[model samples]
Target: MAKLSLCGGRAAVTAGSRLLASGLGAVAGGERYTNNFFLYDCSSAEKKLPDHKDEDGLAMAVGSDTILAHAFSSSGSFFALTDDNKRLILFRTVPSWQCLSVRSVARRCTALVITTAEDRIFVADKSGDVYSFSVTDPQGEARLELGHLSMLLHLAVSPDDQYIITADRDEKVRVSLLAAPHNIVSFCLGHTEFVSQLLVLPWAPDLLVSSSGDQTIKLWEYVTGREVQSCDLSTSHRQDGDEDKQRFAVSRIAASCSGSHIAVLFDCVPTVHVFQFDAASRQLLPGQEISLEHGVWDVAFDASSGLWILQEDKDEVVLIYRLADGKWQRSLNEESMERLSNHLRDNWTLMEGCSDTESPFRNLYKASYDNMAHYLQKKEERILEQKQKKRKGAQQETTQQTKVLHPVTPSS
Candidate 1:
């Protein structure tokens, strides 16, 4: 017997393997249901596809399994997925799962991501065609078309979903605006090969990070089209002999919500690289590194709980690491513990007067403005005072010279 947890639910029970074969489905306290199925029978357990549909059937035109890869919005009101079957799919997540499909020339869908704020979805395909869809209305419509001739490998939307960043096999990373449809926006150019992974730092929306097959990780300012930093992981093990030179490759990248740190995982190696971002120097410093037995495929941080979730490629088990105590825990279930921990940690106040303080940079900017105004005022006063003193001195000197020259007698 194997136990499987429901999607967004806490209950877990040991059920016969038959349930697993039939597909484990769970609905998280709603009229809608989330079905976890596999694209094929041979699909790995870790790669199970998730399908979200409304049980009430308010919007029934979009059928099940119509999306290739989909993700629900934060509000759970809408969901976006890519079919890449000559058309893209945008559907609602409620009981009435109304859907809209956009036709495209790209036959193979590689990656897709949705914005957090607006009702928009960015779809990228193997042919490098990136399309943006707006789902504000029940009928999803194509809002913008970003022309690209290369094969897009990965895509990541900012936390606010205001920006969409795409990495292509043509060795280019593009940043586009979700709010402004006409703007293609910025480009991050440095990788000599195909980019394998793309991640946006949640703490800093302007920061775009990417890893490439060229054995390097590059950071960019997504708005200004500037390459901020680049880390060459290829030479990470230079001291080792040439026999194992090409053994390690970066598989995934994740940044903490505070934007204070980043984690990078390697394909062959079990170790995860933690890089600390220094606000003072604006640089990433090497931090503590941890190793596991299995190759890590993905890494996610629950900011509220201060926990890090690492998914391994070889197993279905998710390793949970606590940031506060540096302890390791295992969970085969998807419970509310993560959300609960986040709520508790977020509301806990360890020190008084710490909550209202603004960031140092903000305070410094305010202080600088005040000082500049005061300096200008004082400068003007000093100039006026000096002019008055000089005039008085000159008057006194002239009178004394007149007296010495016998002009005092005439005045008397």
Candidate 2:
């Protein structure tokens, strides 16, 4: 669901297979939040979304139409999204953007991914269960593929379609065979906090990258459950006199189409840390820290390897950065980019009735409260009571020893 909460407003952007998708939520007329989902064809500059009324001639459910999860197939031929209304909408994007099916899911979906073969779309709902729907049959049933003990936050399939990776709020990343999802391959388990995002490296199919509320990103070899590298954001990015700053949780993780760059956004933070993946060294070298004027909502790398950032700013809802000469430079004069920015700016609202709210990511961090002082104080009190009891016993023994001592002295 992008973990986007409806406070002032919410925006999320994702790019895959030459297609860019954005979901925007805004309060309308000081009442309920109305969300709009947009799909853009980056190559032809065309845009689309579901814009039809129901068969009963009733209006669309404005509040429940918020897109929670969306993705394009690896081949860019199909696109799918799961809305808050539990409607899984699939579109064929090859010839023309056409709605193929709109099936009802059992629960609200948190994440979804389309297979490279474009056969099925695996959806993970908040119920911790995964269901696969057929891509060819419009009237197909959603088959229960797998189940997790905790709520799943993200889902991804390997390039070879052999394994499916699932991340949950229990700080677990499980790798399972796609055909038999119950047969677990391995568990990539090192996160101390809730795992937020997972990305199977496009170039290195066996390696996996995951971010967590623990303020660290880890690279894992999923088949063997080996940790290749772990980078602590709290320490690696520390600046002068910023030691006391809150350890920011990772909100999103994205990579370029070439798999040479990785971008990470922190929850409620205005900075985006870009990493250059060193294939030879198998390391994530720190690249650029793009500081924004407002808090970032989401980020994605396009098919052309352009970095797109969606922010909370009403004036500039979207920004694009391109890599030039080993540095990221802002690209501001593209016509299609301007059109997208203007469309989003027009839909953004003041989002009245919901403000001053804490981030949803705050609850993911491990709770901490120490009672060691109280425990030590009680221990000291017990020690003092024991000493007092021993003192009283000694005094009573001395009182008896007075006569006993006189008798002993007489006997001596």
Candidate 3:
């Protein structure tokens, strides 16, 4: 069998397979088991054409605060998700959609990635220890691999399989030999804040790309741990001095398969910064900036197809985007560059201002607050408000949903 999953689980962590393999019905049978692993026959599930009008992409219904992180194997066949419950659920692609394993760790699982060669996985916890689990027997005891001083933000394995690169909350990226993780390779230094994501360029295996809460996207050599280039993106997305009050940090960053484009996402901002990757100069040049209706929670690129997926805040579905003319834009094609620009003028209505009466207050991006579902939910409440407006005295009971405690991270 061609294993679609890379062995170790880390950022660039493969969580899904683009190939929905055919001829799935031949082995379609009742429930089966292999060494306690449940087999899934995807063909057996009642299938119907998905409605286009419905929300698109692989939508995780987990509340915004509940989902910590999601990863796909380097091969994209296997998918894994770590939730607030500290449970890691692994899913298989070929032959069927089945839950291969569910491992409950002692502490919160922070980051994970599949290895390039073997089919095993590595998981990092908030407590700073790394553990390896074999996909074949994931529930079997996990072997402790390594540990970090601070909370690990992200990790990635080198393409040559010679080393493992890990980034922590305290602005450090450690390089260690894969075979002997305790043996240090070198440290890729100089990130002032927490590193959010790491990418080993596919086209140039020697180059590594990283984004950080320090408001920078940096490139470096993972072998010698030498800085190649760095770009401060604080002013790249926002222009005027008006943005001084609100702090902007890098939430996520992703690179394309060919390493031609890079995606940058920030906290509380609805814009996606597109940077053109200069493989020759080992630099990133500004390209396009695509603004969404809401801030992005996470971003992923499909290496096989060259498409992008964005998880937006307060949205039930993951939005699918595409690269057009060297820039990342909405895949739906309904929102053009003109439309995106129009949003700045028409959609953003300044409602809140500072007491100084002269200082420019933050722009309340209306799209973030104008949620369609929220509006419908408030329709009945609006009717009640009108009724209460007329009635002498009417009791109003507010229904509250328990707020899920979001994971605390250096970057987050």
TM agreement with the true structure for every prediction: 0.57, 0.74, 0.62
Q: Which ten residues in a row have the lowest lDDT in candidate 3?
A: 1-10
Judged by whole-model lDDT over C-alpha atoms, candidate 2 comes out at: 0.73
| Candidate 2's TM-score | 0.74
The local distance difference test score of each candidate is 0.54, 0.73, 0.57
**Residues 1-412, candidate 1, lDDT per residue (tens digit)?**
1112222322121111111111113344453333322112111112222333347745324222223344556544554444423345454434434444333424446666666774666777766777766666534445546757777778888787666777877778887776664477888888877777887775666777888766788778877779888888876633245655542345567666564777777654556777877767666777667776654434544433333433332133345554554433344344443332232233322111222222111211112268788999999999999999999999999999988897535445
Write down the TM-score for model 3. Answer: 0.62
What lDDT tens digits, residue by residue, belong to model 3 across residues 83-114?
54555667775444456776655456777887
The local lDDT score (0 to 100) that residue 223 gets in candidate 2 is 91
Candidate ranking under lDDT, highest first, comes to: 2, 3, 1
Compared with the true structure, what per-residue lDDT tens digits does model 2 show for residues 47-86? Answer: 2434445679885554335566787777555677776666
Residue 379's lDDT in candidate 1: 100
lDDT, residue 329, candidate 3 = 51
Best by TM-score: 2
Candidate 2 Cα outliers beyond 4 Å, as residue runs: 1-63, 236-242, 349-357, 369-374, 377-412
Query: What is the Å distance of residue 130 in model 1 from its true position?
Result: 1.0
Q: What is residue 125's positional error in candidate 1, in angstroms?
A: 0.8
Q: Candidate 2 at residue 3, lDDT?
A: 25
Q: What is the lDDT of candidate 3?
A: 0.57
Q: Model 2, residue 336: what's the lDDT?
A: 42
